[model samples]
Target: MPTTGRVRHAAPGLGHSGVVTVTGQLGEFLRARRARLRPEDVGLGALPGRRRVTGLRREELAQLAGVSVSYYTRLEQGQSVNASDAVLDALAGALRLDDHERTHLRELASRRPRPLRRPPAERVNAMTLDLVRSMENVPTLVLGRRTDVLAWNPLGHALLASHLDPTAPERPADRPNVARMLFLDPHCRDLYVDWDRKARGVVANLRLIAGRHPEDALLASLVGELSVKSPEFVALWGDHRVKPCEGATYRLRHPLVGELTVTQQALSLPHSPEQSVLVVTAEQGSSSQDTLRLLGRFTVTS
Candidate 1:
């Protein structure tokens, strides 16, 4: 891809403005992060003169990012656009950005000039519901493309969805979003002991999803709402972090059975691009396993 050119916008609307804003914000973020690091961080020779700034100068960053000083400057100023992924990666390396920052840079560079809004949420298919049912013993849940908890086995409902009203409709409008529940639900905050870490992880996963589906108005709206409601959520979102939540262990304090540790994994449904199944399990013979068994029994009785 060529390094120099202006990106063409299909129409003058929120989409176009969004792209420009994304690009400008990304450049500003990179510049700010880079300016905080010292030359020794990336093994560059120290300058003799008194340095005015803390980190690499713009010219030095251009040299490190492998673009012309003028071009890098324009990118930072939002003057030149259409940055390719390769260029962004190179710049990320030069800036010594961590994994989260690198992903953010790529996302910004790859953003479409005209982003589309997500359409209405569709109903989950029968087969998908059946799959969740089959995993009844395990805490299994089916999440929509926007990460809405569309369907879940009883155990899953008992484990995660318990934060929301059990009688709430399973539609996007009424359904409980995992991210929202994690931040907004008082029970969720109490359930997860390391609430801050878990909160950021949720935001980062949403960031990755948002980049892939930038036109998704529902996803954008969810993010926007969380940002306003939770100051911690707002701080993490502004960091421009990104990640896929494939697997992780979570400790939950169940009201009925006390504390339990469970390893949660996300599995993509082969037939549906808009659905995924999340399963949670405890290691055999562990105390957490006992708690899980007790919880399962309670669910059965209830």
Candidate 2:
């Protein structure tokens, strides 16, 4: 899974990208997430004068979370590293964080430095490619550690992202991450009927991965790019939630198929925890299953 809820290292703050001390990241993520709130929205009484600052001020956030302003300021400033579960829970509640966001916050608070590893090759191996091909009727994809689309079966491409160039998965540099596509790509954006719920799931899943692979620079870069490009993503990331993306049923408004409900299941590769196969299907004997079966007729198996 994944999260804005990534790590603090020498990570550069929002806007300007590239490596910087991650020390400031927790604060930046907290500040950014907090900036989206309003006083009345959280049941705080409105002030008398013309308000200059946006969202809940740091002091207000601290107050709402049941902590002193100075300590919360320290935490936001990256000065406080001894965050406890109870404190994080309180803070998450104050910020209205979901389960995934809370996990991200915990991960951020507890991060320690490790030498960055050689960036992992995101290419799909021959065996994995072969396995994908074997699943002719299944809408399946091999996802890299960061959820990059490393490989896809013909039905997978047609059923999930037909609008995208089918060859995208072949290029490591240009590979598409399903999470990014969910928010940034128009076709992907319109695919899911419950957009907000889907978005939360994506963020939560990403947050979980962030905790597991803190030293992955590419993963960090993806989060940064998304943060800069999508305000919705930024807000969701700040919520610091984590979700294990095992399986879920989604109602999709597929452009070609009209409407369909499908259950998505992810199976981790035996040798590679970093990658997994995601398959989508409708219930047996259901009309949605009939529609899904119809999609296979148009599958591009080249």
Candidate 3:
């Protein structure tokens, strides 16, 4: 019933230094969420006398979720692996997690992390390539789960990474990663007018992906490389922010054409949860549209 000084997880496979394992992430998330609430916020009256803990204590949270304190404590300690859907739902309700956070909670509590076993190239989708080829005038890209550029239209190459090889995405071994570019590439640094905002959004999307697939080796490598290469990325990743890579407006400072603003939309590939089509376009009738049209004068055909 008393609040412990801090909860410690005992799950195996924790990485060295700053890498957060699945179980460690789960416990930290729970601790962080639990510490942000007040007893009064959840209809519990503040107890008299100086309370040593913030938010709902472990016992109080367990009671609200209809679980024994010991059971909930074990789950937080990463000792429980086969948590039922009912218990997860109860905890989600008790924690008041939104839809995205609820999904994250379920994934983190599911079981031990295991690498996805598939062909080396399963992350690449042929149809995604065909789709990007059709988007001749649009800056279109097909991104792997780890944010690698699986495919990109000529316009996309010109608009986003013209300084790099236009055919970089064609070679599996030499694919250009947008996230890596966002943080580590000097050209990419100069491209974004608001680098901080773009960097934060990129890290947030990566956080969501990391929670879903903690055992992805390529993803882990990318994170480690960025953490070492970019202090900005290290700071952002530690924040545990999650965001869908949906649609957003981006202001770009292109060296050739000066500045232009465009909106980017990411559409998940059907039947392939890890691949997404990233397309960027300017608003119709705006100067950005005209600039983009001039910029995308080159086209690619299948």
| Total backbone collisions, model 3 | 0
**lDDT of every predicted structure (CA atoms):** 0.73, 0.77, 0.77
The true-versus-predicted C-alpha distance at residue 214 of model 2, in Å, is: 4.1
Q: How many residue-pair clashes does candidate 2 contain?
A: 24
Error of 2 at 112 (Å): 3.2
Residue 136 alpha-carbon offset, candidate 3, angstroms: 1.4
| C-alpha lDDT of candidate 2 relative to the true structure | 0.77
Query: Worst lDDT window (10 residues) for model 3?
Result: 2-11
Off by over 4 Å in 1: 1-20, 28-37, 46-57, 84-86, 96-107, 167-169
Candidate 2's displacement at residue 281, Å, is 1.1
Measured by TM-score, how close is model 1 to the native structure?
0.83
Off by over 4 Å in 2: 1-17, 27-73, 82-106, 113-118, 125-127, 300-302
- State how far residue 223 of model 3 sits from its true place (Å): 1.5
- lDDT string, candidate 1, 1-302, tens digits: 21222223321111233332455455656666677667787777876788887688877788778899999888887677788878888888887778866876777666644444446675788998888888868999887776788888888888875656654536567887888888888887888877787887887788666656656556656766776678888777666556777788888877767788889898987788767888899999999988887878888898
